[model samples]
Target chain A: MSASLPSTSPFPFPRFYNFPPFFSRQPTLQTHHSQLRKWSTLILNYCRHHRIFKLSLIDALDTELLYNKSLDKRMGIGEVREVVEFMRKEGRAEWAGEGGKGVGGNEVWIWWRNPEEWASLFYEWVDDTAQKHTVLTLYELTESEATISQEFHGMDPDLLQKALSILVKRGKAQVFGQEDQQGVKFF
Target chain B: MSRKGVGLAAFDRSRITSAQYASHGNSLRSSHSTSVATQLSVFRSLLQQFAQTHAKDIRSNPSFRAEFARMCAAIGVDPLASSSGAGGKDGGGSFWAQMLGGSVNDFYFELAVRVVEVCGASREENGGLIGVKEVKDRIMSTRMEGSSEITDDDILRAVNTLKPLGSSYSTLTVGPKIYIRSVPKELNIDQSAVLEAAQVLGYVTVSMLMINLKWPRARAKTAIDDLVSESMLWVDMQCAEWEYWSPGFMLGTGDDG
Candidate 1:
């Protein structure tokens, strides 16, 4: 007895979005399983489109992430953590503190792209730009107008380092930093 | 004459098969005809013999008890329906009471009472709602180590019989889920309708209730919260759309938990 609902959702919510139980956590095992899957997919897609890296649970609670305005329902912090944790297990998200499982961080990093994928993209860009054997400051690679069109442009430096290191291991890039400046050079 | 083997004064084959129904003038058919009473007596004697011979098996095996009970029923005997016949001054009802426990009916009554006691609550307390499957599991588990198995029909029958106790104990339907309400809690039509919508998946959230019931946020929350406050439900505050679960419907309502 699912409910019938139609709305102008920013994201493609599943048909079950109208089903009341979809909003509530299911008590029965079989139903709850599908519910978890739906929540995980929602989190992944929402994060990818919104480019959400560090998502604060408290803020999400007020946003459509936790409370669907059209539906007028509120998801408790417990369920948010649960779905996000599910994403974490799938390598789609993680606790905002980088990797610690510390209690109640109330935030997560939605990693739609794995470090390996990012590294490959970075390597491909280096080749296309014909920048082999040229040195560029880490800041230039991130904030430079020339890289603005790239998907990883303005990326988190820590994540950038992770990607760049992958290239380094492949003999395609090297990172060097003086007391004043950090630079990465492509081979 | 030695009254051996049921000690019948005579083995009257003509009496059974209703020989009386045969044309009295035609004695040829009389030998083949038998009466219903005679057939029933023969069945009764044989049943008593079986019960006496396999007392231990009948008492230890649920299927065996069910079969025996079925046989007794076919003979128009209820081993546990009443305490007025068969088993002497103790008024032990039928042979069933003497053979089994008090009676099969008593077993079901005990099951019904225990179910209500464990899950029942007033409207203020969460409206004594329970999952039908869970009740069945609990009843089965609670049976004596070796007793007849109870079926869904038995549970339903027991609950139906509870009407004399009042509306406080009754079975109900909300969509596909069957719930036993054991209290005077007033679940409104809106709530009932909302529950009906969610019964397929065994849960409902405030947002879902709001949409399904066409109620305002405040109204939806009030209804769901009312249910939560009453141990009638367990809140699954794990997702963005937090849900409520009837404890009986929950997955891991277990010992490690």
Candidate 2:
């Protein structure tokens, strides 16, 4: 089932998206590799366009990202898994589970921007706003009206923490408080 | 009696007249060659002047460039012929490199490089075979707006310019369409036939091939299998009958997507 996205403009799919055979897994090794590459790019772009942080493969199977409704062709679940596995190797995706052991998991974190990139964005925003020394609760940083216009606004809390941990390790920020109510102070 | 003693004198007169005729012929031959050389020099200067004036058009205008190349061909001048060995008049480089200051030659060379890049990028997908139009589209799409347009003719000429390097790039005709094949692979008659049939609807089934080409089921299957192995065709198994598709169709039929 496709996500009921905002009534914004639909994604402009690449020309190959309309090619019927793109839905099927190519038998040739080279062709299949190329197909996977295209799929990976398309998936990343689609998620970014929709502001999708994590993807459920089964849910996306019927979406335009993996299905060509006009041609009545859809990528099979195994093929989708293969493409996700390819993206995992490229470091653009990760299976959504603890300890990176989500083998055969149906959920994936499509890293349109990796956690490090998200960390830099957060640091830049804090620096630009001159809020360097001010303590900001994790909830305030992601859900505050002040960050409404920011790209990281309403980000998933776990992913935001992962990003914040990078800044913490770098000594650019300090995190203190309970796990559910942590606060951050950037320097 | 006095006239009868003139036989030796007559022979001497005949010899003198023959000597005069030989000298006159020599002078005439020398003058004719000089005049021909002058005409040739005049023509060369005129061509040079024309090329100098229209250098920009030759580089930017596709038809104008084609016509200019045709004129050179008509005059038995190879504009792209490198001047290194046979014709040492220019010392080194091609005729175009010498006359129009290499703009025209550079244009083709640049286009050839783009062609090679496009072919290399898509080699894994199409198995090193791509439609000439597809190559042009790929190149043009990456170009900025208001850039000069490229035609299929220019693409073909660009491929020809790659011959000196002994590249595997060459053009082949399959069913009414011309393709630039960058690999050294050869397709048998049956594979070509299947490919040609696939052009009709972007795909071909064994039954379709069997019915249309009067091929037995085994023969059609073998041809399709051969193409799939070459990566030239992708098989769609979701259909009622497995459909073999031409990868070239990926570029042709998806504009609305």
Candidate 3:
């Protein structure tokens, strides 16, 4: 979904996105640090709108994704790897590998917003609905929900469910499975 | 006279003239002490004036800072303390080290550069060779207590280094207090460059440049020889003097031995 965003550049140098330094990790602290901050902001915004919770390092290297002539931007393997590593450090994503082995050459979640943040966002969405004690189906909580739409803005229903699971861990909500449907009982 | 009479006579002189003599001698002694004190006071005030005016150039350049530090240390004052007082701010070794090419103890060459850089601008103000005494006084002010034994030759070496590739200057001898024929100002270049280069090279000789030019060998030789005879290119080491002859130049002590 992000790759298909109309091939337009919002940054000052529409061609700068294609610059090698844009993708390569910088070593100098004074220069590289600000670059990292920009990258983090760009990725986080992209993730929130797309509801992109997971990003595969392999998939990011897909020629269609990074090297499409339409956007004219391509990231090397190392750059893709570095961006994902940066995301992981911010707790916005993690490896889905077996016993953390996936950290090396791992697939990552693009938690443009971390689960904790998403959980809080979910709480706000639930409160705005003014249905504080009501239980709602995961599908109902995400799709056609007025407050959820306002907050997540077309967030994937599945990723929304994952975000709610984080809230469940914090005793902010309870989840129950009945038949083939799951429901959230919010505090 | 007998011992008693001599004593009586001495007492009588004390009554009539001893007080006057004592007062006169005391006043002369006091004035003499005041003059010595005044010399020291004036010298110190002059140092403070110099340091205040030139400390920035002296401390900012690597070569100057090191040489200045060495000069301070040579006179037995701590470089750090003197620099801080002169700097009038929080001073650090890093500041000195950076200006002095990374370390304080690099060698006399580095110190020479620092000295040259620091003094280069001030050279004009001091009247070049004519102001050698000012330079000497500036250097001497840093001498340690109980060790005011710096020689005129040592001071001359410092001053001669300031004489450019072609220049002359005068210096006074300590013993006879005579103005010996010091490096005369006929070489035609500034002394600051010479001093700076000498400080770096430890010693340097001025000779005709070997580069091919329109001048004939004889003319160049005569020109260089004339300059040398006029005491223009003076080096502390007498051996470092030369004359250019066409393809090459001759280097040796020219029997001023």
Candidate 4:
């Protein structure tokens, strides 16, 4: 597959995806399996290009991937699990454990674009800044820096640290305590 | 807890066909009342109406209330009333309420909930009431894809099963919707042998709507595909992957059924 970012078709995109099965997961083994592959590829490709960090599975029910009106039929827990389990099998997703029993009620964290991508983002972000040698707290890495921009929006608080920690573990950046509870600075 | 069903006694799945005049021919022959003959006459007339109006589409058509009443009278109340209805203020409304209210068995409840939530193409110019033609059209449209092989008859049959469950054949209204009233509070099909086939079968192969009712997954993916091709669960096509959001799911399989 040529990964050079398929030709940037025209605006408003083609509305051809209105087919019913396009919304429903095929019940057949081969079809469902293929459906999963297509979904995962699309999800992963989008995240990689845009650098999306954490994705809540609940967020999957949007107009972007699924138009709300078309959902005339919603996904049941078992169906959602089948897809999530598929994602989990690959290192692409994890259960956030914030909701009720099973992964159905819980939020799923998609690592389709994992912390490694974030680490790369952090490096690029740091490289573009004039404050290369300057130290800043974790909070600043998230918000205060001009380089962070909108990319940090929705990144989980815990996950944000994990992403930063990856950078720390790699010796690309150093994190040390400064003043009190908020005393984290990346150098 | 007994998982409630009409059993083969209430209605046999394999027996009924489009040309069959009496759904309860054997039961009618057994009854020795003169009224039984009259009832058969009425049953024949209703069946004729059903065949004329729907042909094979009889399944989703409104339950023939007159025939159902006769069947109730024939089978006696203990069987029909006990499992099916709740003693209530209104006759039709109460039974309808019970059907819509809730069930103890996790299986059927799963199915009911899915039906309530399923949204298909907007067909009704007059609100959500999908015309029989529209419903058939949607199913037929999918067939051209060369993937799903389900026929309109299969969908109609599945919908017919919901007749007793409360689907307004004419206007798809809001209030007084039908729901499953009697599922076992603690019956475990996973532990039984007779129902083991249905129990182990994947949710897809079980009747389209029935698949939601504590049905098992299919033995293989091919079976599930066949179920879809048959249109047993077209309304549920999109979310074939997800399960319900139940507190019962919180517990493990070993928990009380």
DockQ of each: 0.03, 0.58, 0.01, 0.06
> Could you tell me which 10 consecutive residues in candidate 4 chain A have the lowest summed lDDT?
A10-19
Q: In model 3, where do residues sit more than 4 Å from their true spots?
A: A1-20, A25-34, A62-65, A68-73, A97-101, A145-148, A153-158, A178-180, B1-257
The CA root-mean-square deviation of candidate 4, after full C-alpha superposition on the true structure, stands at 23.6
Which run of 10 residues does model 2 chain B get worst, by summed lDDT? B82-91
**Clashing residue pairs, backbone N/CA/C < 3 A, model 2:** none
Interface RMSD of each: 13.0, 1.6, 29.9, 15.9
> CAPRI band of model 4?
incorrect
| Real A-B contacts recovered, model 3 | 0.00
| Residue B113 error, candidate 2, Å | 0.7
lDDT of 1 by residue, B43-74 (tens): 76776667677766555465676677677778
Instruction: Please give each candidate's TM-score.
Output: 0.41, 0.87, 0.36, 0.36
Residue-wise C-alpha lDDT for candidate 3, range A65-157, written one tens digit per residue? 444354344566776666667767877667655644687665666776666787897798678768778988776766553434354545555
Order of quality (TM-score): 2, 1, 4, 3
Clashes of each: 18, 0, 18, 34
What DockQ results for candidate 3?
0.01
Angstrom error at residue A87, model 3: 2.5
Give a tens-digit lDDT track for model 3, residues B65-172: 556656766756443433224343335543333333333323322333433442343332122222333334434455456632333333444334334433333453
lDDT of 2 by residue, B148-211 (tens): 9888988998998888788899998999989899999988999889888988899999999888
lDDT of each residue in B58-112, candidate 4, tens digit only: 2223244224334545745321233344555356444322332322112223323
Each model's fnat?
Answer: 0.03, 0.80, 0.00, 0.12
lDDT of 4 at B205: 30
